[model samples]
Every structure is written in structure tokens, then in C-alpha cells.
Target: MIEYFDRGAIVTSSLCAEVMKKMRNEIRKKRQGKLEKVLLFHQDNASAHRSAIAVAAIRDAGFEILKHSPYSLSLAPSNFFLFPRLKENVKEQRFEDNAAVVAAVQEFLGAQDEEFFKKIILSYKKFILKVYYNKCDYVEK
Candidate 1:
């Protein structure tokens, strides 16, 4: 999961192109060379980050594209749970704008509890909704 300084203008999801590029680069870095031919592949949506150019770069690097869901949270668990809490924790610190905010955000994220991150994911997946017998309320998926 990745986030930008702000957000992106182009893309299906809100993920910034730079952040996605960085993520792809990081994955490629794990490969010694011939990154376009690596065995491990990532599933990503058709966002700006997953643009045709990005797909070509990824394929050129050597990774297979796994089948992913339309909802990004299914692919990016950190975005669905952990990272938003990090952003919130930073916001709660009440730091001044500019470098301070950035610093606070970084510090909070760096200090996040591993267990909490795990718990958020677990909780998100485990949540169950209540059903009332009154109106036709539930959408059967």
C-alpha cells in the first residue's frame, strides 16, 4: 500500500502515480536484474498507477499480473485498514503545517504498533452487519 504527499488528479483510485511508480520500483529492486522476468507478481487495479505505461514497465521488468478485484481495498489491505489509522494518528497530534505535519505523520507511522495493524485488517474482514426483518434491506451479493 502507498500514499502520496497529497492525492492524484488522474487515476481510477485516489493513489498518486508517483507513489505507484515508487511501489513498482521497490518491487523491481528486490529482483537482482531482469526485473521484467520475476516470478512473483502483484494484483493491481486499472488506476492511473496501473496505466498502460505502468503495465508495460511492470511486464518489461518481468512480473506476472495477478487477477485483482475492482475494489482496491481487496488488493490493498493496508489502505483498507492500517494506513488510514496512521493518517488519523498523525492528525491527532495537532502539529503545525509544513515540515512539522510531514514529520509528525512520518513519526506516527513509524511508531505504529504491528499488532494494531494486524488487528485492523482482522476487524475489517470480520465485521458483520445486523439484519432487521422489516424492509427489504440487505443486498444479496
Candidate 2:
């Protein structure tokens, strides 16, 4: 699921809730019969991400939140994989404005194939195992 907020828009709990609803619908539509009954949703413990309303929205959408250890920012899959790829794609390219930046990000994200996402998922699993083995200590990325 790919989405961008409007320029200067604040990402409050309400906005995150709405985005999650939209993303859930998109995922459901795309997966159709293949959609699982239980969805494991992952996100960092940002204030907006952990807000009561956001949690309620996620539960309402039938997702089970995957918990992360406190202060385990490095364990975030996007930090290890997704954003790095995005930064690489947009690197050295000049955008006219916020919309252009958003468009560039969308284009880069859209270009990624299923194999790329599969690889990230595998890497995430490996990272989780590594963290478990290391007693939940922050492992080097």
C-alpha cells in the first residue's frame, strides 16, 4: 500500500487510522480469497501509531499488532530495507515541490517487484530470530 499525505498535513492518530482503513481495503481487494483471517500488522511505537484511536482502528480492521521491544528503532523493517531503497532511488534527483517528491516516491515504490517485498519479509524474519537469540538487544543493522 502506497500513500502520501498532502503537503504540510499533520499525521495525527485520526489520519493514521484513516490511512490504515484505506490500506486494509486495498490489501483485501488485491488479495481477494487469498487474504488471511488474521493479519499481523507492524509499526514503530510512534505516538500516533500507538494512540488508542489508532489501536482501535487497527483492531476494527482485523489486524493483530506485532509488538517491538521498547527503543528498538533499529529493528524496524522499513529502516533496514524499504526507506533505504527509496532514499537510493530519490538520491541526487531534484524535485520541484512536495508533490513532486511524493510522486517520485510513489514511482519508485511502484517499480519494486514482488521479489523485492518477499526478500524484505524474509529479512524481517531473520532479524526477528536474531533479536530473539540476542535476548532482544539491539542488533547492528
Q: What C-alpha lDDT values do all the predictions have? A: 0.52, 0.83
Best by lDDT: 2
* Candidate 1 worst ten-residue window by lDDT: 127-136
lDDT of 2 by residue, 1-141 (tens): 767667777889998899889988998899987985799888877899899999999999889987776757876678877888889878899989888998888788788899999998999888888777877777765
Q: Best TM-score goes to which candidate?
A: 2
Give per-residue lDDT, candidate 1, residue 106. Answer: 67
Q: Native-vs-model 1 lDDT? A: 0.52
Candidate 2: which stretches are off by over 4 Å?
Answer: 133-135
| lDDT tens per residue, model 1, 50-106 | 777666655654556654444333444455465577776755466555568667666
Candidate 2, residue 128: Cα displacement in angstroms equals 2.1
**TM-score per model over all chains:** 0.48, 0.87
Residue 26 deviation, candidate 1, in Å?
4.8
Deviation from native of the Cα of residue 50 in model 1, angstroms: 2.9
